[model samples]
Target: MSIVVPVYQGERTLRALIDEILPLTSRTYSPSGRPLVVEEVLLVFDHGPDGSADVIRELVSDHSFVRGVWLSRNFGQHPATLAGMASSGGEWIVTMDEDGQHDPADIGGLLDTALDRQSSVVYAKPTNAAPHGLWRNAASRGSKWLIATAMGADSTVSYQSYRLVLGEVGRSVAAYAGSEAYLDVALGWIAGEVTTSPVELREEHGRRSGYNVRTLLSHFWRMVLSSGTKGLRLVSFIGVAFAILGLVLVLWVLASYLLFDVGTEVQGWASTMVILLFGFGATLFSLGVVAEYVGVNVKTAMGKPPYLIVADPADGPLGRTATRPEPPEHTTPT
Candidate 1:
């Protein structure tokens, strides 16, 4: 099985992550007597301002299994992960954060569950974690809740990136045609025999996280949009609700005009204003959602590489590629 670690500015912890996982490759074994030899650890470096790319290139030269996939530029986490999976040669694929927040030990458990269930994807669910600030926790919960509501509560909540996937299944998902590639949502689409096991989140040291509020919001929006018809269905329901409300108001106005004599200023002006504002708002909101759908299709049709391969050794069979046909256009200036 191969492990893929998508490194984006993970300078402080990347070395440790590699050190911890490399030994597990040889130590972990299945009952079938096949030892887990990590055929390759595809470290996809999305050329960030951090000097991580240079460090990873040196690491790759020193270790045969430590292959560096340098992207021409940043293409966000999901796309970079897909690129790493594309480059790896393992029959099984495992993805984990380069930051030590996700324990490498969980990989063994995830693998065990995958083998036991004969499952396509064995996701490591987060069991416990050190407390984060309230807003951060709330945002995290919101993200998970949205995923659970869309995918299924059983399949989501307490979800972790630490996962083991059958090689063929991973490739099949990677081939899924969508510009907004949210990993969890994408996995939700290909719901093969899937199961989850609980794993404790490691204590995070005082390093700043890569994903801030803006990034999180962007990711959440992509997830909602990529979640498929459930989102559209929700929009449809909302539209119907608004249409009914508008009809009810109109009927009430007609009744007042015909018999009740409720006065034009009170009923006509206020009701008209309320109905006009809400009706127009709802119409625009619905159009925005529709536009999001159209935008994804249009972006996919543009034939761009989802990411770029920046720094693989010349002789090595580099495994990663961008999502669109065109690669990311820049590397970190260094």
Candidate 2:
């Protein structure tokens, strides 16, 4: 087993989190009753304003099984996670937050569930309400619902940070992920089966959430965009509906003019303007959708890699000296 965590400002909680996780590396057993030893813990640091880099260096020096990967800079949560996945070499890979909210003890349960159900991925679903204010929780649910509806996924999937994925599947998804890839959505695309296990979510030890309202909204928008082209299909449906309505309106106008001798002059300019404005708005909306799809295609054609690792554990104690080979330069399409 390999445990991967994306560390941001986790200086205070990392020690405790590692201590809890290290013990599980020895005591846990697999489904076949063999001792399940965690081969290594890959901590990928997403450059943040904290001393976590030093902390990780110290931890790596003391523990043999602990390895570190340092990114060139902060690459958001999902990208950092992909970096960790790329570095992991184990039969199963477990990912969790650095805030210490995910209990290390739940690893056994998650593993058992995954093995029993033969699932490629298992998410740790919160058994109780999340540790947040009512309004915040409601907004979180609403965002998740929007993503689910847009992606045509089951809303009950309950995507979360704490998850267990088969090693091969995780690496494959990370390798092929594009610049705008959302981890969960990518997993859904490649995973053979996905399920969830009930777990209690603990509150953060001493810090508030890393995300605020504005960041959360941006995150939600990115998730919708990364899921797929379903949003464009939705716009196409709306355009069709508007076209049908416009046809009906034209028929009504023609029938009124022929049967009752009512013409455009009797209907007045206000009604005419309303119909014209609606048509104009719908046309502009469709164009905007098309533009978005074109932008995505251009980025893909330019060969945008999802994540880059500037440092790895094989380098030395700090793992800050290693570097990945440069990716091929972007080439213009014919």
Candidate 3:
């Protein structure tokens, strides 16, 4: 098993988290009787304001099994995760936050659940409340529900940082994930077998959350955009409904004019303004949706790599010994 963690400003908690995880590296038989071991722990360092890169360098120098991938700059959590997934060479890839909220001990239970359910991915659903304020928690839950509903996934499928994914599947998704791609949404697209394992949420160690309200909203918007162009389809449906309603209104007006001899005076300026406003509003809304899809397509066509690695573990401390050509730029298409 390979544990993939995206390190932001985790200078304080990352070492401790890795220490807790290192003990679980012992070889053992899984529930299915297959031998299981934590072969490697991959840390993808997104350029945060801290000395996380130094921490990762020190860790990798000390432990052979601990690998480091240094990104050119911060690419947010999901992209950093994709970088780790793409670089990881393991049968199973487990992703967790660097904040120490995810217990390394629960890794066994995640494996068990995945095996039992015959799932390609298993998310660790928190059994207790998350370590956030009430409003934040509510917003988080609401966003998940919205995305799941939009994607037609099970409402009970909770998304969390703590997850276990079949390595092949994770790598496959990572290879194609676009700049706007939400890791969970991309996983949902490819992995038909997804389940949840109940795990108690641990108290955050010392680090503060990387996400604030703005970042959280930005995350949600990206997820919505990446899930699919379902919003465009919805707009089409609304346009059809409005067309039908307009037809009915026209028929009513015609009937009144013919049967009751109602003159043009009955059609007031107020009514005309309302119809014009509705039509203009709907048109702009549909155009906005189209523009978003076009923007995504353009980005994909331009070849935006999810994350760029300045260093790889195989090439020594800072990839100074690398002798291969740089990877081709690529991103998930809209």
How many pairs in model 3 have backbone atoms within 3 A of each other, for residues 3 or more apart or on separate chains, i.e. clashes? 2
- TM-scores for every candidate against the unseen true structure: 0.85, 0.86, 0.85
Q: Model 1, 1-334: lDDT tens per residue?
A: 7888888767878888888877775766754444576777888887666877777877788788888876767898888888888777788899888778887766667777777777888888777753466788888887777678664545433556788888877777777636576776677567577788778877554466788889988988887787776667777988889878878877876886898766646435676788789889888888888888888878888866666565554344454343557767888887
Quote model 3's TM-score. Answer: 0.85
**Residue-level lDDT tens digits of model 2 in 145-222:** 877776687687898999999999999999998877778988999898799999999998787778889978867766
Query: Alpha carbon lDDT of residue 240, candidate 2?
Result: 93
lDDT of 2: 0.86
Give candidate 1's whole-model lDDT: 0.75
Q: How many angstroms is residue 131 displaced in model 1 relative to the true structure, after the best TM-score fit?
A: 5.5
Say which prediction, candidate 2 or candidate 3, comes out ahead on TM-score. 2
Q: Residue 159, candidate 1: how far off, in angstroms?
A: 3.9
